[model samples]
Target: MSEAASIAEMPPRYDPNGVEERWYLKWEQDGRFKPDLESEAEPFVITIPPPNVTGELHLGHALTYGIEDILGRYTRMRGFNTLILPGTDHAGIATQNVVEKQLAKEGVSRYDLGREAFVERAWLWKEKYAENIRQQFRALGCAFDWSRERFTMDPQYVDAVLEFFIRLFEEGKIYRGWRVINWCPRCQSAISDIEVDDREREDSLYYLRYPLKDGSGDIVVATVRPETILGDVAVAVNPRDDRFRDLVGKTAILPLLGRELSIVADEMVDTEFGTGAVKITPAHDFADFEVAERHHLDMPIAIGPDARITEVGGPYEGQTVSEARVSVLRDLGAGGYL
Candidate 1:
């Protein structure tokens, strides 16, 4: 075999173990990662999307870094000064969840520890995880400017967020109101609309009977949730429904409370639903609010802030909606109201 062929045919013994570490250390130590404004090299800047410091390297991060590293290396080979900035997010919700879990193990709470001490503890946790992530990124051999790392909750970024809020407020675009915001029960915070993920849910479809005023007949209605019955403001059907056409102007006697509620016709009703009637529970459901508004109906709030039946629910008050549903239904059936 030719000399070149013989060398090529030799058992391949290329081990990246030593060279990878050695090269990284040399590049970092020699300040090759730092930006040089004096040099007239064309710049190719690309920043990796910051991951939460509280998270670990999953399949998603691996894929992201692989693409970024390929681009950075290609640009570098083309003789451009490539700057692939690397960083992590403080991710207040995620980081806090970690620390809170740790505190829970010690039978302590963040509030009990006080803000200063809790923040200190959080900083300690951040330092540990941030170091781990930094080491992992280094292991990946990403040509990132490690010297210029940024965190989302860094003082500089915090200033930016504060400035943004102030500017929006000054423009009269940021106002606070008692609105139903998307709340994260686990995170105990109001999640931004952009952060939410819509999910499919399999819910119960319940049959409920709303009694008539003269104690004669009961109107049976189907609901995805029997729990919301306490909040029922009005019963509605399609205006074109011949069955309920005469009942449109009548009043419905609420199952448990004997409260008189109006019967209204609206286009929002799905004609295929049981009895072709939908109970309007404005305080509990958003769709009901619009229907109530259109009909000029009185909205009696039945669900409290704590998600339990309110004081206005009388006998069913203080109980959870689920528990109250059974009690209310039983009473209605016993009274021959259903």
Candidate 2:
């Protein structure tokens, strides 16, 4: 007997064409995927987490859908009215990226097409991919209610979201507020905490001189962003650090800007970072923001959304951070402040 033609004459491949194809199609045609609304059985509802329209099924999605399908089948066999709602996410960022890449290939940009046209392109992209995701779910044999399929931007869904928002606002459940956040200069947007990728990188620690207002002596404060010193509200030192105990009550003249910076003592200041004295730019640094709030210091906007110096920068106003840094450092060195 040859290895290729063994006595046990079963086919190597299990062809799904004549078997799964017929039954799955019949199930869909007979409306088995949807629950019998008039049935007396107990209702079982599951709204599966929608996948991004710009994405495809990966190992994770396959595994999750498989388990959910098993549970759904078991519940159906137990005579429950199963209603597994299916949907695809609008995935704002992901969809934006897809369209942006398409535009890139055509040597264009979102700005070139303008807001209205760009939005049109986005919708077209969504329409093309949304169906593909549905087909993927169907191929995975997910017994979901396609009749009740949802897209977040659907007119009815939008209305529901608006109603919820209006109700929340009327109940004083939501309000505008300010706090520290992770910002993406390239994307020109504020991102959620989960979106931030924390990694280690090397950068220079700057030591700059802040002369005391009394013309007595200069105090050196360390910072990473020299351009933000234009908005410096205070010089912070660890309250328990003996090195800066006497300097705490004093006032320091901001080097190039000539604005007076209060020498504040706060336990939040890291004793080991830089020179045991850190410049407090509340608008730029999270720890400094908290320190300013506790000590009643002013929080002025220094860096703009475009990453340019704000009006607070005086001579460096309207310059990009990198551009302003070079000029600021040159001026500081020339003025014996660096």
Best-fitting candidate, scored by lDDT: 2
- Candidates in order have lDDT scores of 0.81, 0.87
Q: What is the TM-score of each candidate against the true structure?
A: 0.70, 0.83
**Candidate 1 at 26: error in angstroms?**
3.6
- Give the TM-score (vs. native) of candidate 2: 0.83
**Clash pairs for candidate 1:** none
User: Among these predicted structures, which one has the highest TM-score?
Assistant: 2
lDDT of 1 by residue, 1-338 (tens): 79999998876897777789899989888977666767689998887898887767777887899899889888878888778888888877768888999999999999899999999999998888888888888888877889889888789878988999999999999897334356664566766665678899997666777877866676778887766777788899999888888788788888767778888999999889776989988766778888888888777777665657887888788887678877776776686644
Candidate 2 ranges beyond 4 A from true positions = 1-11, 35-44, 67-81, 182-188, 193-199
Candidate 1 lDDT trough over 10 residues, lowest sum = 177-186
Minimum summed lDDT over a 10-residue window in model 2 is located at 3-12
